[model samples]
Target: MSNPKIFVARLLGLDVFDPLGDRLGRLRDVVVVDRGLHQPPIATGLVIEVPGKKRVFVPMTRVTSMDSGQILTTGLINLRRFSRRGAEQTVAGDLFDRRMVLVDEEGRLEHEHESVLEDLAIERQRNGDWIVTEVYVREVTGRGAFGRARGQHRLVDWDRSRWARGTEPQGATSFVAAHEDLKPADLADMLHDMTDKRRVEVANELQDERLADVLQELPDDDQVQILSHLDIERAADVLEEMDPDDAADLLGELPDNQQELLLELMEPEDAEDVRRLLEYEEDTAGSVMTPVPVIMAPEATVAEAMATIRQTEISPARASLVIVARPPLETPTGRYLGVVHFQKLLRYPPPEPLGNLLDKDLEPVSDLAPVTHVTRELATYNLTCIPVVNEQQRVVGAVTVDDVLDHILPEDWRAMDPDQTPAPSTENPAPTAGGPASARGGAPAAPAAGPTTNRRT
Candidate 1:
């Protein structure tokens, strides 16, 4: 049967399965090799985000089926993480919405006009190799505010489109739009896989709040790299958007001078909070604890506490427990009354005073306590979070289970694959049915049909 042409956009997010019907991951991007100025790029592989949020490359040769909603491949799969190389680019990440000149069949630029590359269409040849054969583009009609442009859209053969050369600043509007729904952690994983240039471009394009959330999920090096690339003022703004403890942690990675400059640029209140956290030694309850936990006064009602935790900005760990203090409910709050677990709030009447239901017997940890002490206290009491009190008996902050785990885990835990079993090296000999390809490179073959339902091997 003749192979059908597929638009690359439709393939994104499709579930990928092995020959035995076991799901391996979802398709995230198409890897293509550049084939000179006027030739169609060859589709080499698919970037699949597998279990544990790790992305791996699957050579096109191993793909057996490409049905709606899912893709099927030969059982042989490499468990190694995907890393892009020179001469290769991702269709969605690198090309989509890129500016290119419209050319005629003779390869001459048409009327000095430019168009935005919106999408690419890839077709499988009779011999099974897949190539990007067509491009959908939108002519740049005019420019508007914020670099936005008005355009008329059309489709053209790939050979008639010439990618504009030179270091024109590429906007990440389309790229961010493609993955806008991704969680911060998943988006961080995708960013971790991108080339440094592309990663910085996308980071700069993201809103401060969104970027802050993603920064917290990234490894320390990545966080520093991205922040260092930004303008000092903007970097400070992003830091202000992050949780006080996270901002302090990231700032701690920089030189003292740079840290002071960024802090100086931040709003006074935000800077103060981060400065307080920075005063503590690393891995201590004071350093890792979030100073913005849901705190209310003793006179606050159960309903008020519930409403406070219900805010979208409050994290689950912070919301799990409400600290009831005296006047000045903020961190460094007035006399630490006690904490009321979320469960207790649910049990009591809406108007019940938080002071009457406080868990007084549950002691707060000292800010100077080591992480080991905090971890043990949390584990012993089966608590999601515990308040950290200063020498004055004021609620200074709260350390949650996540904070403890983050401190206790290996420093490189974010980059480590969750499945610790060693995977067969990609340099190994090919197997009879399906086999691993050379690291960073592979060839294509014809496609075949396979089963769809997921099952264990």
Candidate 2:
């Protein structure tokens, strides 16, 4: 077998196959046994997420070929579930994203400067032991994009890095980068599977806007947990970035004092919107409606309304209808005139006024109306969103179908499905042909004669 040095990050999610070409599972993580201070940890095995999402361990020796998208393993396999043991850590779950100190070649600390672990390169030695050899890291230079630090990214010898003191919190710079392409909901699901400590660490590292988006998709309990762990000032900042209605919902779960403190710390404009929603009873139109819906004046052109809806920041539900109201286009406008469906705008000329296309027959719902009433109105009109009005008949906001569904669903609807597999065993089981014993107890057997090649992948 060739000895290619591969970054652990690149190995994650790669398909794992047996010698007979039978699909087995996907590579989830690399398990390594720490070899103390300056020595690279020996790569002991691979954590494979098999069918049913059950993660099992495949000792390194069992791996026959590892390339770009997949790994070929010898047929000899252990079906027992994989669990962490003394001195053993999984690269993806435990090491990547950790804060570490940079050290010089002489092992002298580099002014205590900090860096985050982004990836680890591992290679099989002549003796057939696979070990971590290089560390890819990003320097921590304070907050930058999305509140995460930005600085030089470098790959250094494994021995040049030292784990930060245990007292310090771990960093999530690399973790967030690795998953940056994931959708907010998918990211939320990923966060749900992590330990609370790691979840909070990642949340704190995320930018306010990004974290706010993720919070909106997470379960209410998760939202509160992540928020409670953030700094008060940052918590307020993140809340401001969230949709007003969602922010209010999250704040409602906190103690009055804590909620009030965060709200007070928020920008006045943002806080005012959230405070308005907080005043309404839960399950009411006003409580779930977004105050910052797309609103336009009676004289606004169809083209203008179309342009407004095209904005990327506006959600589909909010863009489905253009609220044509009296002067003062902002929420709580002069009066609730009517709404123009997006389809209607498409039929009219760009120069045509939105006022002429208003669906005057559609009655608006009162802010105080129950969610059931709002739902009936939306269903009867076949509308994605309906105008919400105050006692004075002024448009205050709009209740979207999504908001209705959120309220109607079970309280635990946002919770992730629990894994059906039993908890992984904590005890280290006996070693098999290519198990931990090679790294922990004694030298691994000699590798099968083959051309030796070492290249970073």
Candidate 3:
């Protein structure tokens, strides 16, 4: 087959084999060395992830052939673990998703302009080494008219654009899309495993909403570490994007002074909810319930309710039931009427008003309800979430089954790698019983989160 220009995204994860056809490992990265300002970087070797351990490298000179099927090596692989030298750059690991500047053909950068390294255009040279000649750069621009803004991609000569200075990468969304399917929890766990400096690098790239979701999944220490790296204003913005309960839990991990500082910097409405959550005992229903959920008026039509759900971007657990209340759907929800479950909405016509379908008899738990009682109530009703109300039956928030599990399960439960099957927990039966409750609507929704890097392409 003729040599085709390949992208870094296409090269990663391909199978590698020896000349004898022995299966070795999957291709992990492409090592390259910059030649000079005139010539683009030249591929030096390939980094491969071995069967069960560290990544290793093989010089391009050892390869007998390279193709989509697999890389046939000369069988002279260097078994030494691959550690990047100061001058070396690896395609997938270092440059694939780096946020960069878009310099026009005249070499001038647009004001506040941003772009990301989508892929590298690698072509084979006569000397047998593949070299990067151009980059697939994607510009972040406003979408035409009504649609959401996004990346506009095109290939460009490598030397035209300079690396963006001091800005965090704008590549997390595209990077996640380029990689295999990833959940927020998975990405958060990966961030936790990285060093603090590395975590900051990745954290800087994510949008506040995505970062908030990942912060919710991470351990308290990791959450605090990431927040510390962000400016107070940005940190507060991220906290506002998070579920109030999750935000409260994270803020609780910080010293009183730091917590107050961030809260002061936050939008008052968002801060009030988190502050209210902080007031409750850690193990109580009030503390665990999310302050933000879909709350609709009893007279809301199914279509209206659906529209509200769409606008909120809430999780399935939060969306499974539309809390019907007396007007003023905001926090301290006016007299709670009942709930219209999502399943019931599907059964009724879209124009049907929720007031008629409200399950008025379903009792709302008090803010003081303990975790044990809360879990039992969820199990008894087969509910993904249950509303918590005050003395006058005003809805405060809803506690999802996952929140209960987070409190009951071992502190390190989320830290465990997903690929490794966890041993059955011998201690608690609450999570075991509540697990199915949380998974009521097929798989629980992944925490909506997203990560990025320095100028590299």
Candidate 4:
């Protein structure tokens, strides 16, 4: 199968494509309904930009096919005279809102496309027509877009061998379409939508890598629950799927019982990685970074680097922090050079020496250092990520702005205080029978109005 042609609307940073090769306006944003009643989410139309004339707002419903370079629409809408709305943010922005398929590293979906994960699985029923199944795990007390997807489904029948164990994959490049009912992208959306309870249920049922992707997008609470739901053997399989820092972060949030359970569930290598990350505090650079990094010896060839990247897992942080070090030191010192971006590395000649590509005049920080330093550096450079190094210059980890935002923002961001900060709950529960209301807390029970038995009509 050919790769699903995906169009990165370069002009607008929006992704739009039709399977049938039609041009549609970029997807600007989506409205999700996670906390309200009867009304479903209303998808916003997009403004298709034209060269000289006016732009038009094309309703997403007009989309007939979504594949590769363009989005096929039901009918052409002349958007030449279109007006702009405030919701036309980039697709990256929409992905971080926590309520849609498009999500950011912080586990929030910025866009809320109601149609995401709306798979058309063809379940054969002995007849010609196939069963169109929408695969999702339902939940009670769930929040976010998860309200629409809550239930226990093992997805036991999926072809695991197709997704893994392949030298050259045979199905769709996206492979998302291979499953009649599920797609990685759609499942990615469900990862953000599921409740802690339901997420755990789904986590236990998927492949480790698949589960890892979902868990990576979940909050601490949900991460713990999902990990808890899996047996140690199965949980370990998924644990290996995540980046070390993420695995550490989730394990750190689990109760003692669950933490131990997950650790035991993990393989020695994965367990060791988490152990290393857990060695530091949540606010520390060490805790937030993965000790496992892509380090290059100064003598290595650029071709070797390319081969390595293709072989190992690469994270957003890793893409930004490619450390070049002298072989003598496990951790490069003043000898340690600055980081080179993945693009730069890829662009360099394959035969170039690592030393030639190393940027020596770089700032380095200790893993034990505060995250604020990383944040400050990122702010100064306008970088999405920064690198952490030891005193000897050995690269220890990379810090991402997304993770920084996660660290700064509280879980219940809705309950902000007067200062626009998350405030502590001011409510106090009512006292039980015979318990003094005043003593039970809450504005001193209005001073109890002692001896107020006087009947002054």
Candidate 5:
């Protein structure tokens, strides 16, 4: 039989019908299983979103014919909720519009080129089953001024790009490889133009830490939309991966019911930190500071401090400095001794205690410090993060410049396409606390303004 191609995008939300031509529901997602690398993943079934019922699964084995955006099936639509099993990948849910590299007829990757999937071409097999045959792609050239006009776009069968499924490298072989090398911020930027449904689909495919990083870079609306789509369990996991302040801010956007549910699902300690941040009124340092940080005790050696940072998976911004405190060390949190900027520690030998290297002059901010004051302090000191202390001068959390920008920028600033990389630390989860604080350079600034506290040394 001659191959008749159907784009997966055209099939999504199209009417699905029974053999008798009676309407059943709309095609919500296409399910497939990975057959290993460089092979086309097999179409196992279709998920139909019936109006009054949960999405139902119809096995492709029983699919009779597909034509003109309609799916005619001989199978009984299983009334039970459609559940994705292990090794199964969905087309609309997983691979639609994902970025992939196009290879030539000889299987060599194109030079300095990439394409966003426009659609998938499905063809019928001899066994009367359907499988993906070709990929429809649109090559995007350079953007025009004001980011308005991008160059000429044409759709083509870029290559015989077959789908290869695996958890570590899921979807097409090219995308699997390319996406692995992309930082979370880059990935977030790529998803900016995608529809919320498509964005959520991609979100579901990302690991918790990666999703958390991407969420931080997305607009608040998109953040809430994507998180709302995630199951409470997964949402909680992503929240745990996020900085406590960001997570708290996001949770504030959700309905109280959902917010509370996700909080309850989170680890008790992490949840409490978020809850505490939530208690602070918006625009306060306490409201924007991350309650969890790479904190060290006064007596910890440079070696021990670096060891603690290395052992913990913190993002670069969080790792920029290791806050040293008295007892009750927790972030957004304990007796504020002082801070040891990562750069200051690198200047000292390993056995030198952090207490000796502490930047004692870096006065801590009150929890209620005004946003303007927080901004000025950071800008004045060329700092990315500063400690937020309670009335007792105990360290509670640290306010990051990024969080400060999130609040002070215009409400719609989130809509801005990141022309540059999102922040100093693009690594997921949290950046490792190893590099010099100045390694991720910021704009040179004026002298520090706050009162220099007395140094014990």
Candidate 6:
């Protein structure tokens, strides 16, 4: 019942428990996630060793906390419930599980970059052997060259394929499909055409990222189908590579059950982000702002701001609009103090303090405030997007309308912009740290950045 305390090292070899306090397995490894901003880490999933040497899987849900010399389980797990990936899923023997992982070595879903094996590739090796089949690689694997050896189908072995069902491309009566391929390009296009179907019939397919990109440009409905159809982990990798907001929006359209399934399947933070946006009304700023913003202290130099932004993993903080704030943001009102459009920040001497060039009269709003107030005030000031302040006046979040139309009122409601707070904005999606950013009622808000912590590789 008390807060569980354990050493990070204990995570390596400690025995893990289920919610029932029953011994489920020994901890095989730890999954570390990197959030661009400083947020607590999440254990994507666990590599567990159950009793009788019957190894099975246990996800974070079955975990309670990491304790000294042990892992607290949810007391609800039984190793019999799930199957674990064994030795065949290795990089040297199993390339299928190695491709999607950015970190971690044994096919555990930890981060986006580490999915090495899911969505396997099909290319002619100079030796004349082709890598036509693969299992969905685990999210974690140590560095090493990987390629599944030739077998009956000449690619993925059935033993591996059964376990990596969703990770590999489906269909085809035989391996001859990819082997007799017209061309990778034509195959890519052909699969794209049937992407909308419940099942795609392809003997050989394009690699994961390439296939994901082609699917992205298709209609929204199509993208969802293809994404959902991929192995859970590989699908997660594609989503991880995508803009969080866009991924969040797309996931929101799915059924609640499916939503949870996909979230459980993804790396923890990515799932949390999607769920976070799902909390806001699809049309509100809460749904639009990427949780990771690059905020700087008003007192800091532009150079400091640049350093912080560059450290970010995905979106570069330096080249975008950077809002000035206090360090470790103590309050919401603190965020509204100033703004420095990216252009203006670059024009000033890097050594100069950001406060020197900031537009100090920052406009902010309570997240719960009517969207109408935001639309009107921003329109009057010719502001692109405004910050959302909390009751304490600390800036918590911002909103935009680049994708969501609900944030922007239709022509019929444009006249009502300046009116008192519109009650309709209160249709609660979820509670946001910053209310929501103002929507686009007229002109667009500046497509700038904030000081949220997100990392891009």
Better of 2 and 4 by TM-score: 2
lDDT of 6 by residue, 83-158 (tens): 2111112121223232322222443433333333333322223443223222334333344456432211122321
lDDT of 2 by residue, 308-404 (tens): 9999999999999888888787778878888899998999999999888888887777887767667766887788998888878888899999988
Which residue pairs show collisions in model 2?
146-207
Q: How accurate is candidate 3 locally (lDDT)?
A: 0.74
Worst 10-residue lDDT window for candidate 2 reads 439-448
Quote model 6's TM-score: 0.44
Q: Candidate 6, 403: how far from true, in Å?
A: 3.7
**Residues forming the 10-long window of minimal summed lDDT in candidate 1:** 436-445
Q: Give each prediction's root-mean-square deviation over alpha carbons.
A: 20.8, 23.0, 20.2, 25.2, 20.0, 18.6
- Using all chains and alpha carbons, the TM-scores for the candidates as numbered come to 0.58, 0.57, 0.56, 0.48, 0.56, 0.44
Span of 10 residues, lowest total lDDT, candidate 6: 444-453
Off by over 4 Å in 3: 1-181, 417-457
**Residue ranges of candidate 5 with Cα displaced over 4 Å:** 1-178, 417-457
Global lDDT of each model? Answer: 0.79, 0.79, 0.74, 0.49, 0.69, 0.48
- The CA-based lDDT of model 2 is what? 0.79
lDDT of 5 by residue, 170-236 (tens): 3323342347567777777767778776787677666567678889888788898999888877788
- For candidate 3, the per-residue lDDT at 218 reads 91
Error of 4 at 452 (Å): 86
Q: What's the C-alpha lDDT at position 63 in model 2? A: 88
lDDT over C-alpha atoms for residue 280 of model 3: 94
The backbone clash count of each candidate, in order, is 1, 1, 0, 38, 11, 63
**Candidate 5: Cα lDDT at 227:** 91
Candidate No. with top TM-score: 1
lDDT for 189 in candidate 2 is: 88
